[model samples]
Target: MIAAAALIAAAPAVLALDGTPGQGAALTGSVPPGTTLQLDGQPVAVAADGRFLIAFDRDAGPAATLLATLPDGQRIVRPLSVAPRAWRIERLPTLPRISQPSAEFRRRRAPELAQIEAARDMATDAQGWRQRFVWPVRGRISGLFGSQRIYAGEPGAYHSGVDVARPTGTPVAAPADGVVILAAAAPFTLEGNLLMIDHGMGLNSAFLHLSRIDVKPGDQVRQGQVVGAIGATGRATGPHLHWGMKWHDARIDPLLLAGPMTP
Candidate 1:
């Protein structure tokens, strides 16, 4: 917990960023210590030291307003400026069958989907998750958010989250205070042994390709608390942790939610 006066004293005179509305803009700014950031109504966890980053969703429309409220009752509002980009949308001329899962795979994927849905629906009354977030795992960043992806010679979906490539069996910690909404081995063709945590107000963190799960459903975890270990499960190429984050159903960059991650 932080004092409101300390938060007010640390807040910037006015929040400012270099970007346009509706475009996938990269926003870098500072909040007062223990303040919470809301961009287009989604919660962004700040660091204890007041540093934070947030990126607009690709589908975010133009003319979005960002709201940052200090614990002391000070508020900063900034209008987003988004630049236009030409997007290439096309239907594959010849889709591969391997891209589609087999019948047996589909049978096993149902429970995984159920677990994910349950995690997404987890509710909490406490708002302590608004505090500063920490890195769950520190390692080489093997992937980024919103990058175009190619799977097995077919154009796949865009990378919706950041990937921290740590060695196999390295412990993965909770990035923020949250309840373990789902903790079980999943059979998804892509994400195996998945774990999702709800940090309240629709902000959730997902750990994929886990080798071992340390927490269980409905368990409360704090920042830097070990939750699982990394592994080459599911469709992974090697041993690593695919850390993803979502605000409601909108996928956001986890890297944007924290300061520069160091291995």
Candidate 2:
């Protein structure tokens, strides 16, 4: 096993890695060109230039393995120590019921879920994950990723994305380059005027509770391009942008990509 380094010879090695190394963090790195890599037994997409990305889940354990096969048929396995995170826990005696959904709503869920799953399964040539992310809208952060909420002493769903509280009509921009995969011109039962973008290699971004969408499916958008506007169009209490990200089925933290909004 070799330690991660910024630059290494054309051998089985880790060239560069960035991110917290904790759950919900997207680990972006590189290896020698033409080398094959895998994360926890799953084949990772390595671009022609050897750049790769792997994101940890919210409940991911404290360790992961990175295996690389060199051009010379040699193999190297690096056991990575993933740091544990302290998630925010909110316990409330009384809260809106999120645990139960109507049967009709549940019936409609299958198609929506399938669409989202199919969108994230896409592996495109656009290298959007290598770019620096920008905030879709500058607003007060109302919620964070991986934060759990308990209602009446029962644990409920953890927040899957960051919530930015901005007034309706606030422009929401694309954080990176991508092709618009799902642009719901009509409101979704749960996500409202939903819009989703595929950033290649099984990584995707979803913008929920949108009031208006500026892009359509198949439209290629660049960094900082406006995709929609903030709104309380779904089950939200007030107007806000719910920015979520996923790498395949593993949900990742978007703030980890965009960082804190400029004060």
Candidate 3:
């Protein structure tokens, strides 16, 4: 199995890869032109120039396989090792509450989820995925990604994003260049004033609990552009910006892509 940033060449085909290799990690690499790529037997999108991006889910297995079929039909196989991370798991004294979904929640949630899924399914040509990501806001980290609470032996949903504790009306910037996909006209019941941006290559960002959305759908946004304001508009107790990122179906850790928070 190959580790991080390893390159292997087979005859006329060349496969070069580099990035963090672990659960919730996003890896970028390139292969020979006209090469088809796959991760664990799943077809991966390859740009015209042979550049590609792949990410491991938060609960991805320790090992994965990458297959590249060159233009000449030569197959290059790569065994990848995905390292595991220790998430912050808290244990509760009582068992999990088994509650049925409310009728209102079930009604409003279906459309909201449909919109999000449609946005993610869009294959945009934005090149933001190649750029270094920046923090949408700089402040005290109120919540961490991949943190979960366990009730008895049952595990609850882990935190999907990193939260920045900021005051209401605090302007939040776009982490990278992208086209706005979903700028909710009205607040969502749970996400509030939500804004989603597609950075291309199956990588996207979602800003939750926003007070205002400055951009509209299909608008091109650059890195550091003001896109929204922080607020406690949904099920939040306080005003903060929840910045979540996903690569296709994989929920990636934004901190891993954006690095340490800066002023």
Range of the 10 consecutive residues with the lowest summed lDDT in candidate 2? 6-15
lDDT at position 5, candidate 1: 44
Could you tell me the TM-score of candidate 3?
A: 0.93
- Candidate 2 local lDDT, residue 259: 79
Question: What lDDT score belongs to each candidate, Candidate 1 first?
Answer: 0.70, 0.83, 0.90
For model 3, how does the per-residue alpha-carbon lDDT over 1-263 read when each residue is reduced to its tens digit? 43343434443237777686898889888898799998988899898999989998899999988888888876777878899999998888586745767999989999999988998898788999998999999999999999999887887889999999999999999999999999999998889999999999999999999989999999999999999999999779999999999999999999999999877
lDDT, candidate 2, equals 0.83
Cα lDDT for residue 223, candidate 3 = 99
Candidate 1 global lDDT: 0.70
Winning model by lDDT: 3
Q: Judged by lDDT against the true structure, how good is candidate 3?
A: 0.90
With candidate 2 superimposed using the best TM-score fit, by how many Å does residue 5's alpha carbon deviate from the native? 23
> For candidate 1, what is the total of clashing residue pairs?
6
Count the clashes in each prediction: 6, 0, 0
Q: What is the C-alpha RMSD of each candidate to the true structure, in Å?
A: 7.9, 3.8, 3.8
Best by TM-score: 3
Q: Give Cα distance to truth, residue 176, candidate 2, Å.
A: 0.7
